[model samples]
Target: MSFAADSPFKSISILYRKSHIWLNEGCIPCDLTAAQAIVIMIVCDFSTLTQDEITKRLSLDKSVIAKTVTKLEERGFLQRTTNPKDKRTYDIHPTEKAWQVYPHIREQVEACFCRMTQTMSEEDRQNFRRLLDTAARAALNQEE
Candidate 1:
């Protein structure tokens, strides 16, 4: 299909949709949606983070982060403890369950990205990543 020469939106949207599907499918064995897997990975990486911190990191709404955290907590993958310095806020920590599944999640994420860039040479892959980062920053109106 021929796309308009001036626009990258169509290609970007298609890539986003396809990548989302691939990631979602890849996460099924872990019993996680892509969003849940991402959240777990972030919390695991950070060790402990507040809902607001997660919200900012992922650029997602506070309510979405709260709900995802609550679900993870209920599923035994995370624990929420009252922050020592902040009585009103809770710090999120990964539980044993999350630790157990961490490797699988990481593998799936790695596999997905590898598949996405499989046809590209190392140099091309690096360039693609740099370009994507530049585009993302521009879209977010951030200084490069």
Candidate 2:
């Protein structure tokens, strides 16, 4: 499946695949895959997001989040507590173990972005971010 060199959608898809591979490699020593590390980071950063919220934020399937959260919990990197207002839902939290390694995780994330955009000027980087945000929101809004 060849896409035109000038196609933005093709570029975005290629970027996502490359980014996933990069993250997976970087996360290997952390005893996590790229997706698991991403989930842990999200929980650590939010500190109070529900499973449903995580699914929406990552645009992943609920079952995938459930499995990832379960694995993290088993690894002592995360804790899930039932939401007081909704017994069926659970709020995810990063454990002390997760906090201890968060700096490394953060650095890995930053390094990936830096490497990806190393060739771009500051202005271009900012514009790229703005455009991505706009496109992402527009895509999500259209789904509603």
Candidate 3:
């Protein structure tokens, strides 16, 4: 019933951005850039996604993704292998180091978020997720 401007999306987004400072600090155990974190998170959740597939899911700028993937590969976190079915395309696979770090990263991110929301009830969390999704669509899917 309300417009995107009327939603609490801004507050939620700001909160996430602020909390993600931990991700940006150079001291994080992951030793990863924000872009690397993004790539790692995506692959951790959905194993064996193509670069193009990641592009669509993230809607991130192609250049940023390319730089991030290159850095990650150079840092020994992942690698690009030719797609068996499509010679022109490449698939990303996490390295042993990436496999080892991913579980820890997932745990840390979850713990950070869980600690932040310790007071919220289950129903409230569910409602917030639904509202957030609706608000995100409204905000991001604006017509020209």
Clashes (backbone N, CA, C under 3 Å), per candidate, total 0, 0, 0
TM-score between candidate 2 and the true structure: 0.90
RMSD of each: 2.5, 2.3, 4.6
Summarize candidate 3's per-residue lDDT along 48-123 as a digit string, tens digits: 7788877766777778788788888899987899999999998988888888778777766666556556678978
Best by TM-score: 2
Order the candidate numbers by TM-score, best to worst: 2, 1, 3
* Global lDDT of each candidate: 0.86, 0.85, 0.73
Per-residue lDDT tens digits for candidate 1, residues 3-104, read: 736578877877778777887998898899988998999999998998888987777788899899999999999999999999999999999999988888
- 1 against 2, candidate with superior lDDT: 1
Better of 2 and 3 by TM-score: 2
TM per model? 0.86, 0.90, 0.76
The CA root-mean-square deviation of candidate 3, after full C-alpha superposition on the true structure, stands at: 4.6
Candidate 1 displacement at residue 52 in angstroms:
0.7
